[model samples]
Target: MPMSITLPGPAPWGFRITGGRDFGKPITVSKVTEQGKAAMGDLRPGDIIVTINGESAAEMLNVEAQNKIKQSPGQLRLQVERWVLMGHLCNVNLVIPNRPLAPQNCRCLHPKPIPLHPNPSLAPRPRRCSHPCSSHPAPPPIPGALMLPSPPGPVR
Candidate 1:
C-alpha cells in the first residue's frame, strides 16, 4: 500500500530557484519562501526563483525521476540558482520542502502460521538420511561390543 504524506506537515518551508524574465532581461534566483513565509518577507511578485539551500530545481527534478533515489518524504534540502543583480547573474541558495511521498510497498506481508498438534505419531518425525541406496554392504559382527584387532606384525 502507498501512503500519501501531507504538505506543510513535517517538512520545512518550500524554497525555489527561479529564472527567465527580469526587467526585460533573463536572470535566476536560487531561493524563495513559500506563500506563508513569503508574506512576511519583502519578496516581490515578479521575483525569479532558482533553487533552495544548495540544490538546483533541475537537479532536484532529476533526483526525483527515480523513486529509489528520492529523499525520504518531507526531508528538506538546499537550493541554488542565479539572480539578476546590478545587471549580472548572482548565484543564491535557500532551504526548501522535499517532494511528497507516494504509496510504497508494505513490508508486513507474511505467510499465515500453522496450528500445532499433540501426540507422538501425530507430531513431526525425524528426517531420513540422504545416503544413496546403491552403497549397501555386509554388516560387521560385534566382538563383545568391542572391535576385533589385527594379527600380530613381524618383529623388527
Candidate 2:
C-alpha cells in the first residue's frame, strides 16, 4: 500500500528523481534540495515514489516521470514508501507547497564526490623475497623429464 499526498508547487519540485530500475519499479528520490519544497515537506533519500498525481509511478518510465513533473504546475500528488528499521516499511504522506526558492538560500542536492581509499584489511600483502640467488625463487627441475639444450627444427 502507498501513502498519497498533494503538493502545491509554484516553481520546480526542488528534487531529483530516478526510475526504471527494472519493469514496474517505482521512481526513487535521488536527492532533496536543502531548504527546498521537498526538504521542507520532509522528503528524504531512498523514498520509492509509487504515484504522481494519481498516475502510477511504477508504470511510468524515467523520462515519463520527468515529463510528468515538468508538465505539472500548481499542485502535484505523490505516493511514496520508505523502508524503516527491522525490515519494516513506513508510508510517508507529504503535501509540499512549491514556493520560489531564493538563489542565495538554495543549496545543491548533489554534493562533490570524494575519492575512496582501499581498506587496509582487504588489500593484498606483498610477497616476501626468500631466494638467495634472486628476489624470486627459480622453478624446480621435474624428475624423470628430458631437458632440451637447444631449440628443435620445425617439422615439415
Candidate 3:
C-alpha cells in the first residue's frame, strides 16, 4: 500500500537527503526527524525516493525535489522504495536502518605523494627490467603448438 502525506507549506519535509551520482539516480533518505512531518508520514532512513507529486524523482536533483515538496501548499505525495520484514504470523513491519553519515575527509590525514611535473624530462623514469628473457631474443619456436607471449613479471 502507498502512503500519501499532507504537510503545511513553506516548511521543510523534515528529512535529510543525499544526492546520487547524477540527477538520474534516486536520492536516498539519510535521516528523518523524530517529530517531523516525515516521521509522521512514515518516511524512514534508507528509503529510495521514487517520485514527488507524481514527478519522477529519479531525474530530479536534491534541491529540485526539496523545492517541489515545499511548493505544495497543502498536500505532498511521495513514493519511495522501502524494505519490509515478514514475520512468522504473516505480519509485516517497515525496517528503518541507521542513517549513513557523510564520508570522512581522509586526504589531509594521509601523506601526499610527490607530484610529477608536466614536462617529460621531470617525470619518473621507466623502470629497467631485470629479467633475462625481457632483453634476450625469443628462442626458436617449437613445431607442434602455437607460441603465446610470456606473461609480464610479477609486481614487487
Top candidate by lDDT: 2
48-139 per-residue lDDT for model 3 (tens digits):
67777787777777788777777866677777754322111112121112211121222111111111123435433333223332321122
Candidate 1 stretches with Cα past 4 Å from truth are 1-9, 12-75, 87-156
Which should have the higher TM-score, number 1 or number 3?
A: 3
Each candidate's number of clashing pairs is 22, 2, 0
Q: Which residue ranges in model 2 land beyond 4 Å of their true spot? A: 21-25, 87-156
For each candidate, give its TM-score against the true structure.
0.20, 0.50, 0.47
In model 3, pairs of residues that clash are none
So what's the TM-score on candidate 2?
0.50
lDDT of 2: 0.49
- List the candidates ranked by lDDT, beginning with the highest: 2, 3, 1
Look at candidate 1 and tell me the lDDT of residue 75: 36
